[model samples]
Target: MARIFTVDEARSLMPAVLRHADDFVAVRADLAELTHDLRHEGESPLGGLAEAKGLEARMDETLSWFDDQGIEIKGVAPLLVDFPALMEGVAVRLCWLEGETALGWYHRADLGFPGRRPLP
Candidate 1:
């Protein structure tokens, strides 16, 4: 019974979504870089447990950010969406203006940006 939203409706929520997205990506990137450092150089690029804790903290921050915007990340595989009442279906996920498609595509949570597909 989750709400489904139209591309426009989703787009309208972007400003807030983007805020969370920015932090999410930054934390993700930092984590990735830290992993790379551990793998290639055998070094802890981010220092110690505080860094790990910080990543988790950032993730919590992003979730809070989404909550503030009234959006929730539901599935893991090509994320299943529960948008507003714009489109009224579970097939569509949020679409951003900068996306290659016109907010008119399907994307899984796992696939992220690469999962975009034309609406049928």
Candidate 2:
């Protein structure tokens, strides 16, 4: 079950979420690069493999942080997260993505990112 967050609670959590999201994004980027290099360069050196593993571990840890906070990770590359919330007594998702300055979007519980509407 998901915990319901007030708008203020969600906003208060955003700073820490953003910090971990940034780290998660960076580690994912590094993994992508390492994958490309391994594919194009015909197998990675041991050190390259080690670095990739380390990045993967970091990614897992960062994601676990979000899990610990009860935030649902919707995407990795763009760092989308959804906080469970209630808008007008109906369940909804409080949405935030990388680069957004604040929690300014939301959607019905059954809808997704495409259904996002700006929070009033």
Candidate 3:
């Protein structure tokens, strides 16, 4: 069974979540640059294929961290995450997207980001 998070429990994890999210963004950017360089120049100054592989591994590890925490990673580029939860006994997700300073939004399990509503 999935771990269901209370709003406060999810909120308490924000600090670590933000840290991993930042790291994921930085690593993703570096990997993109490396890929572009290799494609255009036949080689990159960014330590070649080995470094790219390392970056890929790092990205995987970051994602695994989220999974281990029972948080669903909905998107990579924008770093969207959802904590499984129940709102007034209805299954929902406590949503947090990149650049949001707090866990201030939610949506029904059947709905997605388009259905997001501010937390009451």
Q: Write the residue-wise lDDT of candidate 1 on 7-83 in tens digits.
A: 66776766655555665767877777777776677778585556866787887776665555556666422323334
Ranking by lDDT: 3, 2, 1
User: Which pairs clash in model 3?
Assistant: none
Q: What is the TM-score of each candidate against the true structure?
A: 0.56, 0.91, 0.96
User: Largest TM-score belongs to which candidate?
Assistant: 3
Evaluated at residue 107, the lDDT of candidate 1 is 63
Candidate No. with top lDDT: 3
Residue 33 lDDT, candidate 1, scale 0-100: 76
Model 3, 1-120: lDDT tens digits are: 999999999999999999999999999999999999998988887768999999999999999999999999999988899999999999999999998888999999999898899999
Prediction 2 global C-alpha lDDT: 0.87
| lDDT of candidate 2 over 6-108, digit per residue (tens) | 9999999988887887788777877897888887995664347778888889999999998888899898878899999999998899999898878999999
Residue pairs that clash (backbone atoms under 3 angstroms), model 2? none
> Which stretches in model 1 have alpha-carbon errors above 4 Å?
35-43, 67-70, 74-102, 106-120
